[model samples]
Every structure is written in structure tokens, then in C-alpha cells.
Target: MDISTALLTFLHILIPIYWLGGDLGAFYGSTFMTDPKRSVAERMMALKILNNIDMAPRTALILAFPTGLALAWAKGWVQIPGEWVALAAVACLAWLGLAWKVHLDHGGGGGAKRLDIWIRYAMLVGLAVAGIAGLKGAIAVPLFIGIKLCILAACIALGLLVRRALVPLFGAIRTMATTGPTPETDATIIQVNEGARVLVLMIWALVLAASFLGIATPV
Candidate 1:
């Protein structure tokens, strides 16, 4: 219960709570945005709210990696070298800064967006490799840790999938704003939002599973 361990433990618990809570807020806002009964202005407002609230979950997701690793080290569940753990924290912080820059740029593409995309792709591959290696005993780690890593990889993948699915919805929203809400545009928005919702649910499930594994460490 030293200071570093206490702080890591607090973060380990706090991140998921905010991740799930923020996601729920964003989900609700998205539902409002998709409501045909709502006026365009109202829906637009909801979309804005959703975007702002979503930062919480996105930030949590980025920070989870280093915090989880630090927690594992603190609890003696893993023997990651101290320097490696510190490097992971630094990398996570750098990623977080890149993520915020991308958010502020909002896909305007001064290179932050591209960098963020590549970073996510790199993370996806790295997590997959680490998960497989840990599970196969190439890395000396607990089964629970390996499974948690795999689950986290899945969560990241699902987040990307959700983003892809929502692209069409954004386009449709623009069209609706310009051309007025036609049936086709509304239908497209609804369909894409539904697909994104499914992927989001999967991500939430994986995150909860990872959290449970962290707490229980069930082999």
C-alpha cells in the first residue's frame, strides 16, 4: 500500500468506471441523435454532446495499457523489468497526447489524425502478439494476464470497427442537414448506428471481462 501502488490501484479501478460510464452517456446521446422524431437541430446537438462525452472513454482506453501493466507489476503478478514498465508508461502518455491532438484536430489532417491511426494499428498488432506470446509461455505471465491482453486487443479492434461503421452515419447526417431528411438518408443513419452499437457492446463486454480478470486473476 505504498503511494505508487495505491495510485496505480486507484487508476486501475477508476479508468473502467469512467470508460463504462462515459460510453453509456455517449450511447444515450447517440440514440437521441438517431431519433427520427427529433428535429435536425436537436439531433445535431445530441451528436455534439456525444462527441464530447466520448473523450472520457477514449482517454480511458489509451491509459488502460500502462496502468494495467503497472498494476500487474505492483501486485507481483508479473515480473516485467522496471525500465520496461516505465517505458510503457511513457509510451502511453505519448499516445494520450497524440490522441488528444487528433481529437482537437477532428480529422482535419495536419498529420495528427494519420499518426493516431497508425499508432492504433501498431497497438493492435503489438497487443495481439503480446497476448499470444503470454498465453503460449513465450512470456512468463499468468493465464489471466494473457487472457486480459487478448480481451483488450479485441476491445481495440472493436473500437476501430465501430469507428468504421459510424463513418457512413456521419456522411448521412451531413446529407440530411443539406437535403433534408429523406427516407434513404434516415435509413442509412439508423442502419450504420445499429451496427456501431453492436460493436460498441462487444467492446464493453471485453472491457468488463478484462476488468474482472484483473480483479479475480482467475486462471
Candidate 2:
């Protein structure tokens, strides 16, 4: 790969790691969700993780589009049906917008619930298509594409599950906008921290898929 392509590929891989690892750390950090935790310090640690979890997704969202577009441009792979292309673009835009909301709205309810859910569903589609497209010239089309696609799907699903899991806690925060975060709310955030494992999985999947595609030189 040329230097530019190499850097883009590296960024693609890095974004997911930063995104998933950060998100996963935040998710798994919450050990007190189902339980009323015995220690205040532990809850505090989990809350800290939750506070930063948004950063991962936000960064990933920024890179996903341009990298995906660049890959297609570099390979002249824009042969996707016009309709599919339009759909892909729309999905990309929507995903970006939703991810932005996740950060702009942060932990509040200013419209993140719906956006978060839709982002996962849309990304699930986009990742599926892009991953398959990566198989066009691969050395191991069946095994590589299928496995990577599966991993991406699982990552998207995990993202969705985490979003769903966070709804109640986020709602609580919204409800308590005036009252401020309580011990219970803090615990809930910590609970979400346990989902960090999913983010880590996402990061790994991105690395494997991108490197495989580059090596496969799929077009």
C-alpha cells in the first residue's frame, strides 16, 4: 500500500480500537448495576468510565465514512447499484449524525435514544455491505468475508444492546436534570461500563477486517 493508503488503513483500524476499547472499558467497568455495590469508590470508578465512553464512538463515527469512501474510490469499486450507493450514503450520513448526537446529547435524553438505535441498525447494514465488497478479490473470500462480517454484526449488535441497556439510566439522568446525579444513577452508569468488552471486540474486528481487506486487495 502507498503511504496515504497505509495511514488511512491504520486510522481505520485505530478508530475502532479507540472506539471499542474505550466503550467496552466503560461498559464492563460497571459492576454495581444489578447490585447495590458495597463500595463508593468502586461506583466512582465506573462512573468515570461511563463519562468517557462517548469519546470512542464519536471518534469512530468521524473516520468510518471517509475511510469507507476512500477505500471505494481507491479501488474504483463504486459499481454498487445506484440505489445501493444512495442508500449507503444516506446510512453514512445518518450514522454520523446519530453518533454526533450521542456526544452532543452526551448522557442526556435530548434525542439520543432513537438516534442510537437507528445508528446501530444502519451501521449493521453498511458494515455488511462494505465487508462483503471487501471479498471481491480476496484470497479467502468465503472464510474471511463471512467471519469478518459476522464479527462486525456481533459488534453492531453489542452496540445496540449497550444502547438499550443504557436507556433507563439515561432516562433517569434526564429526569434528574435538576436534582443532579444520585448514587443510584451513578450505579447505573457503572453498570453500562461492563459493556466495554463489546467495544474491545469491535476494535479487534475492525483491525482484522481492514488488514485482511488490504492484504486480500479485494476490489
Candidate 3:
């Protein structure tokens, strides 16, 4: 393979590997956080670990767009314009920056958080539109590629759902930190975790499917 193809191929392999690996670590940390036998401090540590590990998958998700597009272009699987590919790379970088900022400022003021949420919504819409266009022959790509895009969009949606589920979990953590852990607080943590786990698992499955489609290119 040439340099461009080699680089894109490397990224294509790396992204999903890190994404799934990080997600598994996060999942394990979350399970520890919900373990009733663990002390509050231990659970809190697990939560911190979970949050930090989650950044890997979040970064991968943002980067996937540009990387996948570039790969498709390089492999002659798609004929996207160079300008569009450049625009996508810039946008992906910006999105990755915003995602990290939001993570760093988890419970801070409004601006960054609001912008990040809007960005995610915009990405969701963009991916869905791209998939629909490809499927409709507006974009010249294989059916499997379009389906993979749709699955990726679904994974993003599932991520947002998991975030929504974790809202209460965050609140419960704060409550525990402020007033010590209680049975009620523990129960709330466990409940939120269970709900989030379902969504997260769905995301994992979608991501794996997308990866398979990208590799197999099965129509």
C-alpha cells in the first residue's frame, strides 16, 4: 500500500481497537463503582477511572468520520471531494477538542457543555443524512458503507442515551460525597448503572457491526 492508504489503513484498524478496548475498561470500572461491597472511596475511585477511560471511545467516535472518509477516498471506495475531506478533518479536530473540554469541565458553567451537546446532535443528523443519501444513490458508495454509517449514527445516539442515564448517577454521587453513602444512594447508583449499561452494550454491538462492515465491505 502507498503512504496514504497505509496511514488510513492503520487508523481504520486502530480506531475500533481502542474504542472497544477503552469501552471495556470503562464498563469494568462502572461495575466496580456499582459494587455494593466496595467502600464509598473505592467506588468513587472506580467512577473516576471510568470517566477517564471513557475519553478514548469519545475521541475515537469523533475521529472516525474523517478517518473513515479518508480511507474510503484512498481506497477508491468513495469519490468524496478533497475539500470536503479537509473540512471533515477540521471539524473532527474541533469536535474532539470540544469533547475533551466538556469532559474536563464536567460540572462547570453552561457554554462548553451546551456547545458540545449541540455538536453531538449536529453529528447525529449529519451522519444520518449521509447514510440516507448514500442509500438513495445520491452519494456513490456501496450499500454496506451506507449501512455502516447508519450503524455509527445509532452508536452515537446510544451514547447520548447513556449520558442521559448517567445524569442521575452523577447526582447520586454528589449526594454521597456530601452526605455520605446510604442505602438510598447506593440503590440510585445501581439503578442508573443498570440503565446505562443497556444503552452502552447496544453501542458496543453497533460499533462492532460497523467495524465488521468496514472490513468485510459486504453489501
Each prediction's RMSD over C-alphas, in Å, is 1.3, 6.0, 1.2
What lDDT does the true structure give each of the candidates?
0.87, 0.57, 0.87
lDDT, candidate 2, 45-145, per-residue tens = 55556666756765564455556555444444444444654565676666676666665664467567566666568667866775666556432343444
lDDT of 1 by residue, 1-219 (tens): 899899999998998999999999998898888888999889888988999899999999998889999998988888968899999999999999988887787657668887887888888889889999999999988999888888878888888888788888877889878877888888998899889888888888888888888788886
For each of the candidates, give the backbone clash count: 0, 15, 0
Estimate TM-scores for all models: 0.95, 0.57, 0.96
Q: So what's the TM-score on candidate 1?
A: 0.95
Number of clashes found in candidate 3: 0
Question: Which candidate do you rate higher for lDDT, 2 or 3?
Answer: 3
lDDT per residue for candidate 3 within 1-219, as digits (tens), equals 898799888987898898999999998898889887888789889989998999999999888888998888888888768888889899889878887888898647589888888888888998899998989999889898898788878888888888888888877899887888889989999999889888888888888888888878876
Enumerate residue pairs that collide in model 1.
none
Identify the leading candidate in terms of lDDT. 1
The 10 consecutive residues of candidate 1 with the worst lDDT sum are: 101-110
Model 1: residues >4 Å from true position, as ranges? none
